[model samples]
Target: MTDTERLRRWRLVLGGDDDGTGATLTGDDARMDAALYKLYGSRPGGRGGRRGAGLGDSAPSVARWLGDVRTYFPTPVVRVMQRDAIERLDLTRLLLEPEMLDAVEPDVHLVGTLLSLHRLLPDRARESARAVVARVVADLERRLAQRTRSALGGALDRTARTPRPRRPAEIDWGATIRANLRHYLPEHNTVIPERLVAYGRRQQAIKRDVILAVDQSGSMAASLVYASVFGAVLASLRSLRTSLVVFDTSVVDLTPDLHDPVELLFGARLGGGTDINRAVAYCASLVDRPDDTILVLVSDLYEGGVRDELLQRIARLTASGVTVIALLALSDEGTPAYDTENAAALAALGVPAFACTPDRFPDLMAAAIEHRDLTPFTNHNT
Candidate 1:
């Protein structure tokens, strides 16, 4: 906008009073800068000259810093700074304490950190931690459950549709009338139906199978968190037989815990070596019908086990009519770090590989069910 405005923005980004922008900050701006400086320290120049910043070893200091950051910044910015404090400042161990857990903001990333440290968490803080995790899960489900069900349910019904009806109850009247609209007899002012389209009653019958093969390595924490919640939502739908298989060199079927995402998250043991081939083969064994199954592999494609066998298994899966999609990530954090070579290998075998956001996942599943080209979703994110 203006030179003054530009310099002022640069001052914030650079961090520190004498940041060489020739701009001065005071009052709220000054306090906001101090809160940032406490977490990020002073960058003085630009990138490399970063000085360390810490809120000290005590809970009071971290709590006060959290309050100041919340007062100065919005929710999203505050969450990011909190995560940076945990990672950059080594404040993760402090999170295991009850006071520290209560004084922080709750979000998806925080849940990932919590779940990763579940085994080491102090007993006193376990309840508080569960509350925080449950709150975020409930909020996500409230926003996502309806949309996921609507999209997948509609697609399932569409896929199950038949061209001929065996009885009057099975006839899709709307589709039938539209199909014969041009054959209307003007004398009788009505159309004679020659063909029938079934409305796909479904009832309690399983329409399709969906298997989520998730990687639970340390770097894939956030992806697994979102995937678990989505798996719970998908398992809730009656017309689909959904199974969730999580792996980190070994596989664990947490589908039983999918009824409660919070428990499912706790059941996941994060931060381990990855074995993509082993996991895929295990999930493959679970598949009963390849043509009617949608297998989503959520990982960054960093293979720690037989990479060649993984590619071969993927080729076989795609050849047998399984709709295979590779999600490098499933979070709001754009531009995830992934193995480009492995991604390219999967692409060569007719698999659509890319990171997908939670908001876009429902539509992605619907498109997979319809066997529609998923390039638009891939292109939009990639």
Candidate 2:
């Protein structure tokens, strides 16, 4: 790009007049600058440090700032600014205002903030708050639900597929073609089948049991929001007996509300000291068939309860043939702060401890079900 263009971009980045770019913003750019200044003006370590900040306590002013940000920024950038506004300005009261909620761009972080404030929400603002949350949930389910179902369904079908079909009706033709694709004879226009993929003679009643144990600490807000949505999706799969358990210092079984993630999210009490052992013990008690169960512990492994007991319980779970994995995080935040010692011990016990993105989660679950190598999803390549 030209030097003039570069200076203009840098001028926007460093909002100060004496930022050394000698670039001046006008019209729309000026309005954008004003919107950003209100939020970040007094934030430390910026181009101009700690001058003035916040849009003030007026409802219209906050709502106007929200609208200005949306107009000036893309949806992703708008969401980030909204998140920052809440954190930097302590704008929990903005969420309680219907106009502020209506003007705001809803995202996962926003949903998480709303869920955290679910208890204190006023009766008048609750519907609008829920509508914002529901919109985000619908969007996530639209993007993720089909992919999750498809991946898990394929994995489960493969798990139950037989190599030899007794009759033509029992053969899975599409699967057979896929299995023999590499052995196809182009000259004959046919596949040379080395082994056939077929449907099992009898289907198992319950294919697998999935238990999602989530940590609901204040820092784990985003993870809980994503987990709640996934819990609902997992619950919808009839063959998998899915259970949703949320914990802080105490454990609350939200399996009954798993059908509606919004309700399940409302059930969560977010900010407290973590007790991984107590939560794990409660979830383990619900596991009737260990051999057929996949227990996913979504936590940072900060043990407030007995550490040795938690590790021992996990070891016993893995020993009894239950698949156990500890997700240090399950959000776009990448690797969060977790107890390295606990993670290392869990890894030593043949369980994978890693952070997974929401998009990669379905594949992660599929691999766990089919017993596939999980290294790709872990992103631990050094």
Candidate 3:
């Protein structure tokens, strides 16, 4: 590797500590080092090391450090550092403070932490926490709304096209001509269209039902945020009926709050035993049109309820023409922890189970809505 690349690698490995790596950072790199040191450097009695004294017991110091990290690092790196501060420095309690919430960068993980501490947040801090969550939800909506709407809308248009038509008004001439070019007869010096493709009549609109059955067992926090945001987006469309169901031993339908993802997330009760079977049963009940509904179960598949019943429910959904899919996670974080056996069983039932990143989720939904084979995503888990 080049000298610069080597220095970068060593800087990451040593974190903020001044090791004997003979590499000195400058400019923004130096500023990043200082921010890292503030969070990860040693203090008083301890020797100089990567494990630092943390932000100490002072809320102001912690708040300053939060601002510094956001200023120095990119959003993604800042989010990771924020999570690390919460885990390593025991800053979860401080998050209940208004100043701390005000200073921190809004993200899914931070929202998850706030949701976990919901019952404990004082009245004064509750408003601030909700603001933070609202900001994050708005940012996510801006980033994902258009892409999701376009993909699902396109899928609906494609699915509405019929291959056979009895009337000329229903015929999709462009598609029909494209699909029948192979039947051209050179002897007759003309193109003979053997098959007719048409667009479905635009009458009593066929609204698709989308049920987001998400697992909210503490570990699935990121997935919950993504699912809520997507649910809100789907619910906005007049052509789709969207329902949000979050489960952790119990199921809570947040469909009414789908207009605001922040509210939907706040309604969720995180951290509890998972009951996949019960959740699936509830989602199944919501499906009025089995052929048009897409049931996405976002879970790690660590079944705390009846495992056999869970598999049976999934099998029944798939057999009944409901596009049943299992998402182990819905974050950018690399491969997630999920039950291999459960994933395998879902696969056996013709249901694709895999971890899907938020960016890929829109396309995944498009594929599901269009009834396309999900081998591209499912094969990754296998």
The digit string of per-residue lDDT tens for model 2 on 78-123 reads 9888888888888887788888888889898888888888788889
Query: Against the true structure, what is each candidate's TM-score?
Result: 0.90, 0.92, 0.87
| Candidate models: Cα lDDT each | 0.88, 0.87, 0.85
- Compose the digit string of candidate 3's lDDT tens values, residues 1-382: 9988787768755763456566777887887777776666654433244454567786788888888888877888888888888887788999989999999989888998999999899998999999999998999999999999998887777777766676799887888888889988889976677888876646337558889999999999989999999999988877778899999898889999999788788888889899999999999989889999999999999999999988888888888899998999988777998999998898889888889988999999898888888999877644
By lDDT, the candidates rank as: 1, 2, 3
By the TM-score metric, which is better: model 2 or model 3? Answer: 2
The list of candidate 1 runs beyond 4 A from truth reads 1-16, 19-27, 42-53, 164-173, 184-190
The 10 consecutive residues of candidate 2 with the worst lDDT sum are 373-382
Residue range 272-340, candidate 1, lDDT tens digits? 899999999988898888988999999998999999999999999989989999999988888899999
Report the number of the highest-lDDT candidate.
Answer: 1
True-structure lDDT of candidate 2: 0.87
